[model samples]
Target: MTGSSRRDFLRDSAVIGAASLLAPATMVASTTSDGAPDVPGATAATTGLTPHPGPLHEVAQDEAYWKKVADQYRVTNAVTNLEAGYWGLMSQPVLAKYHEHIDRMNRENSYFARREFPALWRSARERVAQFVGAKPSEIALSRGATEALQALISQYNKVGAGDTVMYADLDYNAMQWAMNGLAKSVGAKVATLDIPEPATHANILEAYTRALDANPRTKLLLLTHCNNKTGLLLPVKDVATLARSRGVDVVVDAAHSFGQIPLSMDALGADFVGINLHKWIGAPVGAGAMYIREGRLDAIDLAHADESAPPTRIDSRLHTGTVNFATMMTIPDAIDFQQSIGIPQKGARLRFLRDRWVKAVRDVPGVDVLTPDDADLAGAITSFRLHGRGTSQANAAIARTLLEEFGLFTFQRNGIAKGDCVRVTPTLYNTPADADKLASAIKTIAARG
Candidate 1:
């Protein structure tokens, strides 16, 4: 937080805004236009293949391979970044391309803005729509998931006085704050249900079903496809089906789930879905998207923004004014990078690393695993608490000691019934060795008492 200057924030915001506006095709075009050689191992044809039996996993683990990927980033060696869930460091290709976009916009000025920005942004939306399995008209690019959810909730017409909006206690705090504010302003009621630790598909389904049943006036149900704190993956399809049966619209907060897992908005059956590309997709920060189902778009009002020719231009509504074309443009690169790794392979590797760490410390005498062990119920992230130390003191001590002693970075969440725990997340870039390092650090910390 100390090094973050206001000028730096404004510059990054501009880059991210531009990137969010331009579509994948335009990113490709802009890259080609700038004469920065094509991304190694990526081509239009190579972007659409499934993983085959081969050496990709071995390649993924190689230090040289990751170093080459890491070279794309401008990160310092000051800390081991285990906190990618909050924000992923940008890769070299994206960073370079982002600067290229900035230069282009600055060079061409109004000509590029008037002639090319619109077409490029439209193409980006179309590509994003295709990636998420939604129609182009249905997708809206947002600064982040918070804005998407805020827009949807603020614009939703049905939320009022007697209406109820149900969400879980484990959901992200920002959206919860927004929901609380909306409840106060619109005279709506907000109800929160407790999600059990070590959850199952049935446990989650039943909890939500009971919450909905208990609140007959519930008009909307908000659920995170993956809980930010515990990293518990909810049974979204099951919840969506049940919510639909009860005449409630399901707005899914998929901020952490979208690119982390293989996702298709159509198959999930949610009425609305919001995701952050900056997280798992590895797009630069300030990039997020929203999916409003066809025919259901009219149900929600649009937040105030400058309009284009068409009333249903969802991207125009979400992205307004002079925006950063660079960050949005890199979405295609990020998607291409993820696609090259293959979702299933990446997911398998993430799970393997997560399990390795969980198994190592799960049985420690004073340790308790807070997330569900079932793979279907979670991925990448796992949380736990020290038994005797409880929440506050345990979390503080662990956080301080880990950074001081082992150079391990982690997140802390307190006040849950299961006690305070550290959340360790492993991404595709992480190695089995990283997991071992984390496991060793946790064990050492636990032994101190």
Candidate 2:
């Protein structure tokens, strides 16, 4: 592939990232051939709630209206779901669009895969990159954050014999595997540490300071912007700057942050990162992205090559096998749904839900909430252990009790080095009533103890 072919591939692929085909919140549009007005609409197609025109945080406070918004999903009456930290189920409107894309894929098959799928995949990549203030050339599509993480961590080349690579116990388990593998590939030493229990913003930074200071030869650091196990939000920008000053390159795992928290590439200050669109962006199960800052591309090798995609191109690093054409094509609907709701509002709603539940049971004897008080150090995702029980079986049993006794579907997060706990994450769809029910379940369990 020549330079023109590369440009064509990029140009064609860039169009698929549309959050919605209806209109855009950020882009100015030109009139159609029929002279129709090109302004964006305020109303969400699924929920019918026109996001109130004002500061996003203020709009987030209107719960009466947000309840109506939750009605947009084909949710169940089975249980009050508090496990939204994983895949964010699609809204009915988005699901309808997704089904349509699936039908189109089935109908078109090879024709679409050959001529249209690559561009759609690129579009999905571009939209994800745009949401984070990145360039199309710097983004790659993946099945989920795990694959993106493996590519970035495994391919990291700056570390050499005796140089150290550092990561915390809270980092995603799959990424931990990649970092451990990196030790063999680059002949680098692995330095692992733990986040202090009952972590505060200052204490979290202090922990990183000690780790970097103790490992003077550490050249690569793996930072989890938000960890899956505890849902603890680390001060990545501060830590990344700290690492930079120590001459260490940082790779971030933001698998749980992008849509649940307000951020951009510049906000986190990481040169390389892997993000999950499926988690908070509400894309389908297999959608996620990887980002490599332009100047830092050479720090990691491509997992696979595109004769057409240059080494500097981020997508070149993602040697994703035969792509899921249907799943990739429907990503725009998720992006559109997120944009319709407003990112700031989505973040505020999640944090609001988290606080409501954690506050409800925080002071209860024998109940412990693991999230920090500082807003920056926590968000919608929070975890807790009963009687400080940290074993995998203990946490799993607690989750089972929540379900069997109280009809609450929550998660048992078992990977924290400090201990195990149950993670409860509330999304835009969850109501305050849902939070109250979860709190009541915790109280009931604690009262028995």
Candidate 3:
């Protein structure tokens, strides 16, 4: 497509990515109106708890209040979607801001990107740093959590030939792959372990402790604050403390945990971490950040030996040549929307939706719920295996059956030691009714077997 045609096509679409929407550097800037006004009454005072009467736990059960929050998203009722773990739908307010940035970027082209974007980029990074309780010098923007993490793992300079690197079965698949590749490149050994079935505070800690004790030569350990496959929230602070005593440095993948839960760099107790802006914070696609604690930059080598920024700055850690400029600019709007609703309150509601279905089928004869009911252990994402059905094909059939027979959508996940499971993740757009529908569908399917 011609450049003008491509820009027009992107402008009409609901979700826009980084394409050639800009003109040549010498092109004169065109004056265009910013697309639309922000979402009405989307201020902090009206979003999260200001209008609710009781505390957060009580507010979670308040269906009327939640319905209002749900209206902010343009979700379809064609199917009861429970696969929000993949990525989040940008709220109307954030979406509007995104479109506005898109128009401005397209109109001004390279002129805006070259001269104006640097300051705006720094400001956006600062906002993310402030929201996550880290310093601006410690945060660097990336395409997503996976990009940031892969760079951190591959470029990590501490591992030696005889050392060991380790991860668990429940960790993200891409991250696990990165660990393996890192070990291979450095001639280091890879140690893999399983997160205990029926995971709880005590048993989970014991499993990690046992693995660490068994592998004394371990130098770098990877931790996922929230497991993507099972939504198992790890006790990172405790595990990081344990690893530190053994001289093992920890790198955390907080992709799903940062905005889904009440999280901060301080709470995680890990100096190196990667987070996603698009997942729970509701930013546009192609937005994420990495954190490297002050004085720890030397441990993570510069990306591709990039000298674009000084070695002391966090931006030197990775190089993403060209990115969605508009997406980066909308970071503050997404952060604002999330903060207006409050992370603690959002997490409580998500857990409430998760519990709504899990509680109903937990004791059923053929069903096995993988995530614990402990609010501290899991959030919106939960997975289950039916009648010990965990093979790739069996779980795929289960997921297909749910979609075809019950009009419910869920995803099948594999990697846990016990077996494969179908993951159900509810977001702000989902309601109590959707969770109940899922419960009924699962009960019927399990009964027929």
Q: 28-141 in candidate 3: lDDT tens per residue?
A: 222113312244323322234233546879978888777667766777768889999999998766676688889889999977765566667777887889999999889988
Cα error of candidate 3 at position 229, Å: 0.6
lDDT against the true structure, each candidate: 0.70, 0.80, 0.84
lDDT of 1 by residue, 88-174 (tens): 655545555566677787899767655566555655666678778888778887778888887776666677897888878787787
Residue 213 Cα positional deviation in candidate 3, in Å, after optimal superposition:
1.2
- Listed in order, each prediction's TM-score against the native is 0.84, 0.89, 0.90
| TM-score, candidate number 2 | 0.89
RMSD of every candidate to native, in Å, equals 7.1, 5.9, 7.9
What is the Cα-based TM-score of model 3? 0.90
Cα shift from native, residue 359, model 1 (Å): 1.3
Q: What is the lDDT of residue 116 in candidate 2?
A: 66
Residue pairs with clashing backbones, model 2? 16-123, 17-123, 19-336, 390-420
Better-scoring candidate (lDDT), 1 or 3: 3
**Candidate 1: residue 18 lDDT (0-100):** 34
Model 2, range 230-346, lDDT digits (tens) per residue? Answer: 889999999999999999999999999888877999999999999898888887899888889988888888665454456656656777766677787777778777877777788
